[model samples]
Target: MASVKVMRMKLGSEGLDVSAQGLGCMSLTPYYDQPKPEPDRIALIHVAADLGVTYLDTSDIYDNHTNEMLIGKALKGGVRQKVEVATKFGVSFENGREVQGDPAYVRAACEASLKRLDIDCIDLYYQHRIDPRVPIEVTMGELKKLIEEGKIKYIGLCEASASTIRKAHAVHPITAVQLEWSLWARDGEAEIIPTCRELGIGIVAYSPLGRGFLSAGSKFSENPYEDYSVLSLPRFQPENSPDLVTAFKRVSRITQAKGCTPLQLALAWVHHQGNDVCLIPGTTQIENLIENIGALSVKLTPEEMVKLESIASADNVKCSRYISSRATGESSCTPPPSSWKAALKRIFFYG
Candidate 1:
């Protein structure tokens, strides 16, 4: 019912057209903190659909697969086809934490997700995290088999490095790679962006708003959610305060000049990057979802872009988006080596 700009893109060359601005479904259910009521969560998704958001991002690991079941329940009847469903697998939850990737484990995970989703074919299936024990080739090999069996329409990877992305793409065309890319956290630009661009893989920029730091209400003392705050992590701490808000301030100045909210400006920057890039900023509050949806309407200019990059670069915000040695299974092959110990000291303290 609400009027907003809509951009459609092909899932790789799969011929499937999905909304340029997708909804990140994880926040509505859990993984950020306390879980919302299931019925209320489903209704929120339907609310998003009515708002013109057509691509949804979810994962099997979130709430231990409760997220997918929430999605399936929300999109009952003909609502399923109203949006493009994207979910990830691979992370194993044994003792209340993420375990390494295993090829056999991934296969079973996919089947289980399929059963829970109640869909014969997944719109986009991703390896939630890369398994060091199982080479990309082997994991991709299994994913390729799923594609052959018509279990998944497109294959994707999350938090994968450039080389890993390429190797997986070589085995089977990777339609998309989901990663945390925002003004505050931008490790992806180092190598992942070029690799994805060269390979023609779509970039799903999750947390494009810097996890709400760009929003007008965000502040050092304020938590984005009751229990969730990207800044609450060890990286976005007060120690790295200067770098933490530098990019947001730059965006603020630019957006104020354009007569738009900083949140709109941040989302607009992501939208303006290129056709290949899509942003998925999630929130449970309906008002916030509407505010995020309005980002599609804000447009950035080349001059503003230059200023933003300049200010962001000046700050040199040092922080690992994930907790130390935590992002092990998916983004990197091994744990953070001792060489990173120096960089760790420069990290912003949150939580």
Candidate 2:
């Protein structure tokens, strides 16, 4: 197969240039299923970098830091110079999963990520989840300090509300806002997307393929419970499985006419979102990664975009994206600094 040349885009008005299509490294871990061997995963990363898919995204919480360690090993021997590494902090699993954004925690997390990635500085550092107990301002304050100390080049936030994004951007220019945006996940479009555009902040779209549902379709329903990790999601539950199957069939029909796989069409839909938007579609297989990169070649007319939107509109997709009470979205808003201590107490006692 011929290597697809990836185009570049600026993440924000701050002038951080990265490949428009990035590699989400979560799947390289065991989040979806048992991870592939270390050699295979590392080779996938090298292939991604070689193909110009250089915006590699990972997080500290992914498989308890193993994902970052894997990336570190892959970037050895000067491969680091060819890619832009983006990893996130917050959302600790130390004691049954907690979201932390305290200034102290933020500083410590940045230091730990720096050490684990074996890099002097991270290209783009993001807070994986908003800490409702801590003010967005407080989190951004510490992240800004990291930038000054040369620990991270740019700042980003994931699953943050429009209000929280605006407040955080005030502390320092937020280069990107990472969110779950896909054909089925259009909740961000109603508010968060406009907010990012209004502030000139680029969007780093995670789970752009709807957690692989748009790709695998009804096949996920088969032995869904075999993988307890995904079974916990409402979208994959027995009650909603039929709806997902129906939706995928509709999307598959369009792909047939376009002469592309459902995965390519799904990713192409995201690619058509805008130049300011970058989508990270994760895959462990080399073929899938190549197919994802091939999305750049699949073009859609305006009418086709509208047709696809109607098929997987948020209303059409039943069940919430996640079952976690802490699942953040465009509506996620943090409390003020004055109530930070009180919120922490509630979380400790109730949760």
lDDT digits (tens) for residues 1-351 of candidate 1: 447756678756556577888898877665556766777778778888877788988888666677888888887878887888888886665755454456677678888888888888898998877777778998888888888899888998888889999999999899998888776667788799889988888889987877666674346435333433444344555466555555556666777778878888878888888888888988887778888888887877798776666665624555456546444523221223542443333221110
Q: Spell out the clash pairs found in candidate 1.
A: 130-330, 232-351, 237-349
lDDT of 1 at 303: 85
List where candidate 1 sits over 4 angstroms from the true fold. Answer: 33-36, 95-97, 221-228, 242-247, 314-316, 325-351
Where is model 2 more than 4 Å wrong at Cα?
95-97, 221-229, 324-351
What overall lDDT goes with each candidate model?
0.73, 0.83
RMSD of 2: 6.2
Candidate 2's displacement at residue 240, Å, is 2.7
Worst 10 residues of 2 by lDDT: 342-351
Q: Candidate 1: global Cα-lDDT?
A: 0.73
In terms of lDDT, model 2 sits at: 0.83
